[model samples]
Every structure is written in C-alpha cells, then in structure tokens.
Target: MEVDATALAGLQSEVSQLADLFKRRLFEDRSKNALIESVQDQVRAVNDLLRYREFEGLFKEALLAIDRLQSESSTPELVDSVVDELLEVFRRRDLVAVDDSGIFDPRVHEAIGTVPASADLRPNTIAAVHRTGYVLGDRLLRPAQVTVVVSVDD
Candidate 1:
C-alpha cells in the first residue's frame, strides 16, 4: 500500500526534530565534561599551593633554629644534635642542601657581597656562604647567600 503524502511529511518532521534534540543533548554533555575538568584542575592547583605554604613554614623554622645555634656558643654535641635535626627535617621534605665548594654558580647561589681575591682563590669563586641554599628534586627552592671573590684591581 502506498503511504499518504501528508503522513510521510509528518514522519519526516518528527525525525528532524528528534535529530536536533539529540545534537543539542550531545553538545550539552560535552560542555559539562569540560567544565568538570576545569574545576578539577583548579582544585589540584589550590592543593599544591597549600602544600607549598606548609613546607615554607617548616623551612623557615628550621633555618631560624640553625641560625640560633650558630650565633650562640654551644657545645659541639649540642651543635651536632641541632644540625642533625635540621637535616632530618630537610630530608623528609625532599629538600637537599646546596653544596658549598667555593664554586660560585649564579643559578643556585646569590652573591650578597664580594671579597678581595687571593692568590689561591680565583675571582668569581665563592669566598663564604652567609646562608645555605636548598633544592627540591632538581628545582631550586632557595638560592644560597654567599660572598664571592673579586679581583683587587676591579
């Protein structure tokens, strides 16, 4: 039996409406998924910032303790114990001390002052370390404060 023209047109209209509805729904789903991912990324960033703040506080405390120990005339045993405790805290936080080998590196060391270069010590070499620097997993957390040797003529 032949289908009625009016009936066929009505069926086509319904199919078109259904297809449009499906497309709209798919678009909405994708937008919702993108919004969810953005929120997740923001949350992760906030958590990372909080962790960094906590680590900063702990590091400052350890530095202060070490400074006090150095300023005061303490027994060798007490100084050793204090140093060990500071090191333990750093180790737990994955912080490594920057080596002070009289070698000056601008990347990890901050030259606070300059000293006269001697015959044995070359210019630009680290003469003294005023404050120790630290690194976290190949990333510098803080630059070491140091005094560098400068040529007497310069």
Candidate 2:
C-alpha cells in the first residue's frame, strides 16, 4: 500500500489549523478568567459599602432617640424606654459606646475644639462631648468628638 502525497499534505494542513484554534481558545479563556475575577472584586467592594451604610444607620437611630428626649411632647418615660431598647440592640451587636470622661486619647477621641482650663481642670482632659462614638469589639467605628481643656495662656 502507498500514501497519496496530496492526501498527506491535506492532513498536515488540518492539524496545523486545529493547533492554531486551540491556542486562540486558550488565550480567550485566560481573558475570561481575568474578567470574572475583576467582577467578583467589584461585588465584594459593593457589599462592604452596604455594610458601612448599615453602620451609619445605627448611629442615626441613636441621634433620633436623643431628639425624642429633647422634644417636650415626648414623655421622659417614653424616651427612656426607647433609649433602653436602642442600647439593647447595640449590646446584641457587640457595639459599645465610647466613654469620654477621661484624659483625651487621640486614638479613640477626636478633639473638635479646646476650652480654657479652669483652675482645677487639667489640660488635655476631655471637657465636653460633642458627639458620641462607638466601638465593635476592638474596632473603632467612630471616634468620640470632644472638647479638650487647654491652658489659658497656651
């Protein structure tokens, strides 16, 4: 038996074409994989942003409780009950209110302004709290905005 020269050439051409097609397919697969990874990253970022928004909502709820207490129409007992319920929600989530009655710590407190120290008050001590802050476990959600007592001369 003998092989035809034209048949052999035709077979070689088909194999070469298949190899090129395979290489192109591999390249396209790589590009698809990269795009899939990018999309996943963007999805994760969006989820994180949504979680942050929820955290802000919690703070707003606390502010609303304060507002209710200040409004004369709302009874003190009703405001107290609302505040207690809100605090329980925070307790369940492991969110604790920051304590501002101490030496000012830059790590946990933000000094929004400074007041002249009284004869007994020490400098760098927290004088007033402008805004309440909270912490989840060891993570700081927000720093307490406070007024610091400063020496009158300085």
Q: How do the predictions measure up, each by TM-score? A: 0.59, 0.57
Candidate 2 lDDT score at position 43: 99
For candidate 2, the lDDT comes to 0.89
Collision count for each candidate, in order: 0, 0
Best by TM-score: 1
lDDT of each residue in 1-154, candidate 1, tens digit only = 9999999999999999999999999999999999999999999999999999988978787988788787888998878878888887877878899987867999999999998988887998988999999999889999999999988874
Off by over 4 Å in 1: 1-76
**lDDT for every model?**
0.90, 0.89
